[model samples]
Target: MNGVSRGTTWRMYKKHKFLFMMLLPALVYMFIFHYMPMYGITIAFKNFNFSKGIWGSDWIGLDNFERLFGTSSSFLRVLRNTLVISGMKLVIVFSGCIVLALLINEVKAKVFKRVVQNISYLPHFISWVIIGSILVEMLSLSRGVVNQVIEMFGGTPIYFLTEKYWFLFILVSSDMWQSIGWGSIIYLAAISGVDPALYESARMDGASRIRQMISITLPCIANVVAIMFILQIGNILSAGFDQIFNLYNFRVYEVADIIDTYAYRIGLSEGDFSLSTAVSLFKNVFGLILVIITNYVAKRLGHTGLW
Candidate 1:
């Protein structure tokens, strides 16, 4: 029995050796970049001193966190901004992507479909910095194309970037536009995997295109939608920090700043690293809770879920 088990283990190892070899680079990268930096999470609990270093830093036992919550009035504001903006973006971004995928699926003309797909996907490759600059130019109060068109229509040029009420709107809209095509890729792939026979049957049953989409297409990809929703819900605290940081200004900070941005300001600008770490730690803990709850809900509902 022992000899048989040993031979079976050797056979299995030999069979999967190439697969293990293929995964080595990715495992090494994960260890070096992701897992290594996770050790810094401890700074959240410690009153970190540059001279003393991470290990030598004095243990403050939540004093940093106390300062973060008690002293910073903007803590709640930033948290609120993060959640609200992220929630809105998650809905709009995913909905837009799904809609684009469904619409593109319905296009019978192959040439036009390909052209539109390529054009939409092009924006995903552009950096947020470039997108921000382009947006600024296009929305410039004086010489922008948007203003030019507005003036042509005898309308006043609106300050889109600086307006408090409009900042979140602009952030969500631009985020959706930039990511819609790229985001649609997964849905499109899922749609492609769906059985064509389902569509044929729906057609034979006298279903219209919209009806077929509702009755046949959506149900087939429901798992994919659910999984994506779970993943998006997991990151509800992060609402495109890069995009907001680049596009926002002090004028719209009340509405535009999120936890990540506030951390940057307080930690880097104000030299309060310990407090910033606490804020970040708080965000991560809440994010962890969200992921756990979402995954649990997904599993109970009989959908594809994170394990």
Candidate 2:
């Protein structure tokens, strides 16, 4: 019996040796990059001083969180902005990418399809700083192409920046422009997996192109869509710090500031390390809770989850 068991173990190990080897790099990368950073989260609770170090820093408990939630603070506003912007981005970007992928899947001209895909993806490769500068130039009151067109029509130029009401729209639009094609890549892959026979059967049954998409294509990719939605829900607190940070200024803070940017400004810029750490911790904890809850719901609903 012992000899048989040893033989079975050795055989199994031999069979999976290559698979295990392939997984080693990814496992190590996750341990280093993802799990390692989790230890730093304790800085949120302590009054961290560089000279004293994280371990030797004094424990302030909830003092940082306390001051943030206190009255006369912009914490709530920042939180609200984060949710609104992130929620809108997730919904719009998610749906738009799927739709774009579907439309691209329908195009019969291969060269034209490839051209469209490349063009749409180009903006994503550009730096946000360059994008922001481009936006500033194009939307400028005097010299911008938009203003030139407006002047041609005998209209006054509008100030898009430095305005609270338009800030959310600007953030969402630019983000969408930059990300739409890149986001669609996953959906396109899902579309490629859809059986060609299904579309053929639909055509034989006299189904319109739109009907085929609605019934066959959409259902085939439903699992992918559901998983993406759940993952996006997990990051509800994150509002694209890099993009927003590049485009926003104090003039539009009322509508434009998000949790990440606010933390950077209050903690790093102002040197309120403890308070900033508290806010950072709050954001991370809520995000963790959201991801868990969404994943649970997805699992219950018979969808792919992040578990």
Candidate 3:
């Protein structure tokens, strides 16, 4: 049976040799960039050393994880912050993208729709570094636009970033602004793929635009949304590293410090590479479990899943 299966597979490969050739570059790229780096996961199980290197380090087998969850680690605090921020983003940004896509699809004016799409896409391309600097300037106590406007109304200037709740608001809002358009692109494409006849039939049945969107458009794009949502859930532990890193400070660390930033500090600054790798591994394992469970639930609920 094995011999027959191998021969059949070889024949199939030979039949589609050119198609496989077209896929060669991606396969090679994935191997070199992604698969090759997986060996570094060993660092998580070893006492990684600068001199001895990842391979030569002494095997420590889960000690790093023990240290990670130790009382002094602050892992629980960072985990809480990560979940809070990522949960907010998942709810706000993800749903906002879908709403934005639906609104764009309903626009009758082609020129205005295109202008809005282009403008929305522009923010996604702008570097987070520049956005961070802009935020700092716009929120500055002495000369910031927000402060200036507040003072104009005879109100005291509020330093926004340092305050925890205000910082959380800014974090979630800025994340939404940066990502919504780009995120909506997938939903827009999915929306475009929905048959126009469906909408027309809904209209003939006296279904309003909102009703059509909810009943026809959304159902058609639900699989795509599910796949995207599952992917997002898989990275729930990530929160937003680059944004928070650039915008956060000592004052807001309680709210802003997430798993990635915590790892960055310990790995690069404190030189605890092993614990850092373990922390990452811990996060990724939970992520994988979430993806699997979510995919299973999605499938059971009659939605297409990542598998």
Candidate 4:
């Protein structure tokens, strides 16, 4: 049976050899940059030494994990922040993108839709470093635009970046602002594929544009939404490292630090490669588990999955 399966697969591949050739570059790129680096994951199990290399490093078993679980460890705090921030982004960013895509689709004026889309996409291309500088200037304690407006209304200057609750608000709202337009591209594409007859029928049934979006457009693109949601669930622990790192300071670390930033700080700043790798390995493993479970639930609920 296995031999028959192999023969069938080989024949199919041979028929599509040109297509496979086109895919070869991506396969090689993934192998070189992603798969080949798996060997370094062994660093998580060893007490790494510069002189010894990965293979020769002393075995530490679960010692590094013990430190993560130890009292006085900051792991829990960072992990909590990661979850909180990611959860908010999951809700706000997804809704923002979906709504933006639907609204843009409803617009009959092509020029206005294109202008709004271009404006929204412009921010996604901007580097977080530049965005950080812009945010600091816009919300600065001294002479910032936001504070200037508040002063105009006789309100005191509010330090937004340093406050915990406000910092989280900034993270979620900024993520939504940066993502809404660009992230909606996929949904918009999916919406375009929907049969125009469906919308016409809905209109004939006395459905408003909003009703058509909610009843027809959203349901039509449910697969894309499910797939994107599942893919993002796998990165739940990540929580936007560039944004948080650029925006957060010592004052907001208690509320803003996440697994990636914690791993980066420990690995480079403190020179604890093994512990940092262990932390990363744990996060990846958990993320993988989350993906599997989420995919399973999605499939059970009659949605398409990554698999």
Best by TM-score, which number? 4
- For each candidate, give its TM-score against the true structure: 0.95, 0.92, 0.95, 0.96
lDDT string for model 1 (116-197, tens) is 9999899999999999999999989998999899999999989889998777888988998899999999999999999999
Mark the regions of model 2 whose C-alpha exceeds 4 Å error after superposition. 1-14
Tens-digit per-residue lDDT, 1-307, candidate 4 = 9999999999999999999999999999999999999999899889999899999999988888888888527999989999999999998898789888888888899999899889988889888889889999999989799999999999999999999999999999988877788899999999999999998999899999888888998899998999999988999998999999899999999999999999999999999999999999999999999999999999999999989
Where does candidate 4 stray beyond 4 Å? 1-8
How many clashes would you count in candidate 1?
A: 0
Each prediction's RMSD to truth: 2.1, 2.7, 1.7, 1.4
Best by lDDT: 3
Off by over 4 Å in 3: 1-12
The C-alpha lDDT values of all candidates are: 0.90, 0.88, 0.94, 0.92
- Each candidate: how many clashes? 0, 0, 0, 0
Clash pairs for candidate 1 = none
lDDT of 1 at 42: 83
The TM-score measured for candidate 2 stands at 0.92
State the weakest 10-residue window (summed lDDT) of model 4. Answer: 64-73
